[model samples]
Target chain A: METLKIVKIGGNIIEDETSLNAFLKLFSNLEGKKILVHGGGKRATSVALKLGIESQMVNGRRVTDAKTLEVITMVYGGLVNKNVVAKLQALNVNAIGLTGADVNSISSEKRPIKEVDFGFVGDVKKVAHESIDKLIQADFIPVFCAITHDGNGQLLNTNADTITSQVAIGMSKLYKTSVYYCFELNGVLENIQDKNSVIKHIDSKTYKYLLDRGIIADGMLPKLENCFDALKNGVNTINMGNTDMLIKANDNFTKITL
Target chain B: METLKIVKIGGNIIEDETSLNAFLKLFSNLEGKKILVHGGGKRATSVALKLGIESQMVNGRRVTDAKTLEVITMVYGGLVNKNVVAKLQALNVNAIGLTGADVNSISSEKRPIKEVDFGFVGDVKKVAHESIDKLIQADFIPVFCAITHDGNGQLLNTNADTITSQVAIGMSKLYKTSVYYCFELNGVLENIQDKNSVIKHIDSKTYKYLLDRGIIADGMLPKLENCFDALKNGVNTINMGNTDMLIKANDNFTKITL
Candidate 1:
């Protein structure tokens, strides 16, 4: 199988213009088949606040309400995705921006009203791998916003890292897929204060130990869960680091394996 | 060649949820390969105002300054586009919402300052019909919002009618293409006040007479120009009417011909 890379850029990278442009330039330089999945949480929150919509968060995940969904849909699906695509076009990368709603690429169900009614939030049901693969084979790089649709006319806010893993797992059948989780961190750190204390490699057993010891928590917890999910489900490699891990031969990133 | 229909919905339909849903259902029932191009000017304006961005318009064309560009990107590319796509997906149309930047499908250059400095507005340069056709043949209907990209990293506000015609003309090479202009008016009305005064058939000569007589002015002027341009450029037929014209055998439409 030929190589395909799935890169998920977290909200922090997307929040800063300079960092986003820099990341996009490096992303454009990445060879072989690739897909970009992105989140725009910070921008969405700010935009919502400007419109007088209060944002609520529980744990690391957002508590999406009606107005909040519209904000994320506009920010993630429209502003961030299009700008990134235009930048890639400028760099001669054939880019197409998409939400899960486009071409029914990913379908999810509204999270049932259980512990928290994450209003208009979707837990992804399926990824249309065949459809996306066709676009990749035709040489179009897809940039996905962190939004999904329930097949029955509802748009749902989804976790971007989960989207990345689902897409990677789906595509792994056709390619030696590698997943990259790019964020503000150098990598998953043993000590949050010490930049150099990057945990270079982690496996299932080590990850369990880390969880027991409370080393993996908050935002990084859900992200690592996604990484391990991808690895367990046929994805070849998973890397967690800053954008430098894309263009640089950096040893300061955490690699996840099953 | 197989038939391909390009339908451009004026912004009014999109602004009203009921009308847009009615139009989408009518659109999905149309029996062939089709593309839907839409404008969200009203919604964009409203959203811009909510975000405290003043919209400046010169005639019917938006004067897209830096701030206005961002507003449209979020409104047209994100909110309106994604919502429409989700709705169409629900209708089982397999709609893929796009701006010209996606897959490098359409490339435009910034409009030259000839009397009016329409900042960040794009004049249609070329349409990548082949890339679009591949998706069409793959069973995905393209839903284009009136946004285009200059190859140099800028997303420009484009006139939706121009996009409709240009795409039809481009795809006419591979398919017997037809263009539909659906707006608030019944058709090209002989008198602005009379709904029954729709000019049913308009040849190029007749179009000129109407133009000289001031029957075709304001917003309809540039739209008619695009119609004639497409007709001359190998597009087979052009129809201008309200959304009802899509489903009904209505004589309340002006059909353009050479």
Candidate 2:
């Protein structure tokens, strides 16, 4: 079976030039199929300030008001996307920056939650993998931002992790492979306070046990959920850790299996 | 009369980190009310290549197809705007980055040119100066991307020069002052071949002569038109050139008066 990798980077990784450059270098060296999706929270806040608009965050997520929506579109869709593409180009990597709004590659629905207006936030409703697969077949890495479109023609800002997971699951369904969720940390730790206690492998039953025991808390919950989602949706393997661990399958990374 | 300034920077200036730093330094030292609007055409093109999407440019303007539009939004509004704001913040300059779609401060109407689908491009149709003024009044520099809204809630990419001119004209009308259009060039030259043959001053008649002779071509045409429009719209003085010329009204700068 052909191997395809979907990588999701957070704002911390995307905002730091040195880290981004290193990631691009590794991306250039990688074989097989790969897709990159990035987050833009930090950049969006700065833009909000420049427009003299104050950003309102609810439960650690940016509330996309009309003003915030504009900033998100400009920053996620315009600035960071170009920066990544330019860096890859400098290194001779064929990469393309895309959002859900383009060609409707990823169709989403406006998630209007009761009592809380997320503004223009989107929940990924579907993924049209044909265009993405076509690009991958042509040896181009699709660098995506978390922004999406509601079938009604409005751009919606979605969470990077969710978008990446959806793309990974979608690609996994289309082409049997694995999805890697990489970060600066080593991997998901058995103890929240212990960095060296990497949880090597966890099955669906074990993952639920850890969650029930409160071993996985805070930001790690969403990521682990994404991993499980990918596993359930036909992904062969889900790896979570630093890229170094990914490159070598170095025993330290957490592997989610059926 | 209260003084107001609108500065439009080309993408080339922002692309160079050193130039961008120098611009920020000079920008921080300026007094009175001011706003920044910038362009990012080259960056957009670079990102397009990575996605394997070929950029289409007609008559020197980017033909923003759906994919190109996505790239533009990411590069211009997200990366460039945030970088500018971050640099300014590091330098202790209170700066804010914004797009026209934010706060409805800058609104536009879709261009109705037949047969040419300038997909998601806007012509500045309205300028709400009160919100901008409030920001300036609170001592923040507004760094803006040349993107706007099409009144129908869709985001539209706009021309930086046109956006600057419109904002300047609007502010001048509100505050009764002049607007400065600054660039890297040492003003408009009389002899295209001679760099030192700068036209220090051009009245309406001489400006028309230059246009008729075809010496001022392409992008410069819109720039000149913007200058003329600003002047006609009650902006009494228009200056074009480098920062040095703008600061001191030196020999290398072009001054237009009505």
Candidate 3:
């Protein structure tokens, strides 16, 4: 199987112009097949406020009502995705922007109302691996926004981290896929306030020890769990870091393994 | 050569919920390989107003300043394009949404500054016909919005009619292509007020007479000119009508020719 790199970027880099340009320049230089997954940040909230749509959240997760979904569809799928693609094109990389709805690339089921009604949020149920593989084989880079469709004319807001994991797992059938969760942090830090306390590696034993020590809790727990899920599946390797780790061999990141 | 249908739709149908759905249904049912080109209407203007971006128009064409371009990218490329593609998917059509930046499908040069610095607008320079052909051959429907890229990290506002013509001309190399300009009007009306005054056929001679008599003036003039240009450049046929013309054989439209 050929090697493929799948990178997921969150709000921190996306909202900053300088960081986005610098990161995109390095991403454009990555060799072989690559996929980019992006998360919408405060832009959606600000745009919603401007449009007079009030955003609702439960447990730090957005409740994607119809209006909020429309805002995200416009911001994440449109502004952010196209901007990244255009920049990549400037560097001679053939990039295609996509949502789950395009070419039925990914399909999801609306999250059922269990305790909290998350409105139009979806849990990914399927990935069109064959279709995406064809795109990669044709030398086109796929830039995905965190919006999906139900295959029934409904677009749903989804989690970018989960999307990255699912897509990496799907493509693992034909390629040795490595998934990177790229954000502002250098890596998983032992001391939350210290950027230098990056955890270099976390095997299952180390993961258990970190959890027992109560160092890795809350949001970081879910993210690490998602990475572990991908690793346990078919994804070859998983890394969490800033953009520089992808370009240079730096230990300022967290590498996950069984 | 295989037959290809390229349809361009304006704002009338897009702004209306019921009408847009009906048109998308008809579009999905159309036989053979097809491409859809869409225009963003008052939605961009309204959204701009909300975002505090002032729109400038010169000779009825938008003066796309940097701010205006961002709004349109959000509206046209994001909101409208995704909605259309998702609807088509519900009808079981394999639909993919595209901007010129995606897959480098289309490339343009920023319109050089003359009297008006129409900020970030672009003139169509090249179309990646081969990449599009591969997509069509793989049984995917390409839905395009009126946003293009300069191949240099900039997304430019473009005329939807010109995008339609350029794409039709580009695809004419490998397929027998027809371009349909679908909008509010049934066809070219002999009398502007009478809905039943549609002219059934128009050749170069008839078109000249219409212009000479001040009949095909203003907006219709540029549309007809684009049609003629496409016909002269190997496009097999061109039609102007409502959505119904695409579904059934109806004489309530005008056919253009040399």
Instruction: List DockQ, one per candidate, in order.
Output: 0.85, 0.09, 0.82
Chain A agreement with the truth for model 1, given as TM-score = 0.91
lDDT of 3 by residue, A24-105 (tens): 8888888888999999888999999998999888888668898889899999999999999999999988999999999999
| Order of quality (lDDT) | 3, 1, 2
- What TM-score does each prediction get for chain A alone? 0.91, 0.92, 0.95
Query: Residue A256 CA error for candidate 2 (Å)?
Result: 1.0
Candidate 3 DockQ category? high
Writing each residue's lDDT as its tens digit, candidate 2 over B44-105 gives 67655745678787777657776676667677876576556656655655555666754356
How would you encode candidate 3's per-residue C-alpha lDDT over B190-247 as one tens digit per residue?
9999987999899999999999999898888887887888899989889898888887
Question: RMSD of model 1, in Å?
Answer: 2.4
RMSD of each: 2.4, 18.4, 2.0
Q: Who is ahead in TM-score, 2 or 3?
A: 3
The lDDT for every candidate, in the order shown, is 0.89, 0.73, 0.90
The sequence of per-residue lDDT tens digits that candidate 1 reaches over residues B109-160 is: 9989987889999999999999998889788899999999999889999988
Lowest summed lDDT across 10 adjacent residues in model 2 chain A is found at A85-94
Q: What TM-score does candidate 1 reach?
A: 0.93
What would the per-residue lDDT of candidate 2 be over residues A104-192, giving only the tens digit for each residue?
A: 56768888688677888889999867756765664556788887766553677888888877887788757876777778778889876
In candidate 1, which residue ranges exceed 4 Å CA deviation?
A57-61, A191-193, A205-222, B57-61, B190-193, B205-222
